[model samples]
Target: VVGYELSNGQRVSKDEGIQMAKIGEIAGVAVATRKGNEYLRSLPDENENNNLGNLPSITD
Candidate 1:
């Protein structure tokens, strides 16, 4: 999920994962950059879930 955001410092969220899945279904990497940016806008809060500390939020 954070693949693109790693170096760019964008971000990734659960919703983006969903969008990525849908976009990927129709085609691969098409408009993916935009989707990734959108995902970055709503990036997930690491502590939104169990608060395990540094744990990732499951999107799929």
Candidate 2:
């Protein structure tokens, strides 16, 4: 694992960086899902939550 300094001036382990990157990715997907759900809920449809089934998965 390669270590490096982040923009925050903190040294982070490569493993930690990988973990942080994964967390950020998951957060982004969650936000997208939330927004899509909100928009779908506002519409008069019975298929609102169905779109959530297509959310991206976090995996190696």
Candidate 3:
């Protein structure tokens, strides 16, 4: 997972998205750490189809 395509059709780097999420500029996501690396994770919800991993992939 390199980056994300925002709902507004804008693409941001992973670091930028992390910062946004930290300041509450983004919603429905929480900052998480795995294996000493930080990343964004979707808040648990009833919608399985909306999971971040289930989203369509994009290319640079």
Top TM-score: which candidate number? 3
- Model 1: per-residue lDDT, tens digit, 1-60? 543322234455546644665555322223325734643232344545432223454433
Instruction: Itemize residue pairs with steric clashes in candidate 1.
Output: none
Which lDDT tens digits does candidate 3 get at residues 1-60? 889888898999899999999999888899899998889999899997877888899996
What TM-score, over all chains together, does every model reach? 0.24, 0.37, 0.92
Residue 58 CA displacement from its true place in model 1, Å: 8.5
Instruction: Give lDDT tens digits, candidate 2, residues 1-60.
Output: 254344455666645654664566212222223534311112224655534334332322
Runs in model 2 deviating more than 4 A are 25-60
Question: After best superposition, candidate 2 residue 31: deviation in angstroms?
Answer: 19
lDDT against the true structure, per candidate, is 0.40, 0.39, 0.90
Candidate 1 contains a number of clashing pairs equal to 0
User: Which candidate wins on lDDT?
Assistant: 3
TM-score for candidate 3, residues paired by index: 0.92
Return the lDDT, model 2, position 36: 40
How big is the positional error of residue 28 in model 3, measured in Å on the Cα after superposition? 0.6
